[model samples]
Target: MRKEVPLLITILTAFIVILAFFLTPLAQTQQILLRWYAIIGGFAMFVGVWNLLKKHVFQVSRGKNTFYSLVLVLGFFMTFAFGIYSIVKYKDAFYINSPFMFNFNYVLAPLQSTMFSLLAFFMASAAFRAFRIRRLEAALLLFAASIVMLGRVPAGYALWHKLPLIAEWIMKIPSMAVQRGIGIGITLGAVGMSLRIILGIERPYLR
Candidate 1:
């Protein structure tokens, strides 16, 4: 009974949503569904906050990595508090402009930037390791990569104007074609999976 009821609701909702998308007259129904989604999403945020609080409180109480746990809890609550304060008090400001902003901008921003910057070094190392002059295909790939790198920079343009033209062609033509093909494939796959779930053919979510 429990499984059947949920499945019935899912099928009904999916049908309504798809029908609303196709039928222009049912736009209001779609809007209502979107509002319901927002309400549910807001409630889910509260649940997430509760879960985060529970985990950190447990860690702090047990004295297991208590310092880091405290930092996590403090950061989370501080951000939440600032968000509330900004909404209630300074309603017109761009951001909260609280301690949260300072911490995020100064400390977290630099750390996050540094972490992402390491990716360039990792990519370089990986490329160096993978790059071998053993085959024609490898040579072509290397040549293309070198041209792309040179074309994007001022020094490369100064060295040769053809580099920029080649880079532009690669970026505009082949890159766009590949991107569009992947996007279409992904959209089709998503639609197929969604239909399967709506039809109750996929029920992994059901116990």
Candidate 2:
């Protein structure tokens, strides 16, 4: 009975959402569902914070990577406190020069940039492995990657007048075709998963 109730709710919600796309009458119901979604999302965030606190606190107590866990716990609380203070002071969490925004701009953004900068070395390593001239496909990939990299620079144009034109053609034609194919595949997978949930064949929440 517990599983049946949630399954029925899922099916009904899916129906209303699909109907709202084509029927004007159910659009308001869809908007109501979206509001419920936001409310549920707020509750989910609170649950996640609680779980994070529990996990990190246990890890800190058990002396398992205690330093990192302590750092995470302290960072979360500091960020939360900054957010609360900013909201109380200016009624806006991200007002310019607020402590929260300061942390975001200085601490978060730099960390994010550093993380992506580190990824460049890993990506270069992977590309080197993938671009090795072993098969026809790998040779073609190496050729395309070389052309695209060179085309973006002024020296390539100085060396060969047609470099930029060929690079643009490869990007617009073959690259775009592959992108579209992958996108279609992703969309179809999403649709299939949605249908499975609506039909009660996959009960993820119950698990």
Candidate 3:
């Protein structure tokens, strides 16, 4: 009965939202339900934090990857403490940008940039291997990529006047068409999946 009730509510809510889009009479109801959704989502965030705290604390206590677990736990608690301190100091519940923001900007931002820089090098190495002229498709892709890269720079215009135009044509025609086709496919797939969930044929939420 518990499972059945949740499934029924899910289906009913899905239909109500969909109908509200097309029927003006249910618009207010949809807005109220959306507020309920936001409230539930806010509560879910605390549940997630609780779970993360438990996992990290357990790891630290058991001495399994103790250093990493301790670091993670300290980072989490420090951030939380700073956030609370900021709110109280400013007397604004939603106010951001304090010691916490400084830590994020100075400490985390550079680390993230470094990680992304390393990722770019790895991606370039991968592209070099894949772009080798081993097959017809690979050859064409390499040619197109080279043109786009070169044409976006000043050197391509100095080297060849027509290179930029060709790059633009390739991007605007072939690239745009492929993107549109992929977007349509994704939209159709999402619609099918949503319908399955709304009909209660797919119960992924139960798992």
lDDT of each: 0.85, 0.94, 0.90
My TM-score estimates for the predictions, one after another, are 0.80, 0.90, 0.88
Q: Candidates ranked by TM-score, best first?
A: 2, 3, 1
- lDDT of residue 7 for candidate 3: 93
Clashing pairs in 3: none
- Per-residue lDDT over 1-207 for candidate 1, one digit per residue giving the tens place of the 0 to 100 score: 989998998898888888998999888987897899899999999999899899999999999999999999988877778666766666632364755566678878999999999999999988786676577878877887888889999998999978899988888887789899999999999999999999999988898
lDDT of 3 by residue, 1-207 (tens): 878999999999999999999999999999999999999999999999999889989998998999988999999988888777877887643455677677778888998999988988898999999897599999999999999988889999998989899889989999999999999999999999999999889999885
Instruction: Supply the global lDDT for candidate 3.
Output: 0.90
lDDT of 1 at 28: 90
Q: Please report, as a residue range, the 10-residue window in candidate 1 with the lowest summed lDDT.
A: 92-101
lDDT of 1 at 118: 100
In model 2, the runs with Cα more than 4 Å from the true position are: 87-91, 204-207
On residues 60-143, what C-alpha lDDT tens digit does candidate 2 reach at each position? Answer: 999999999999999999999999999999899999979999989999999999998998899899999998759999998999
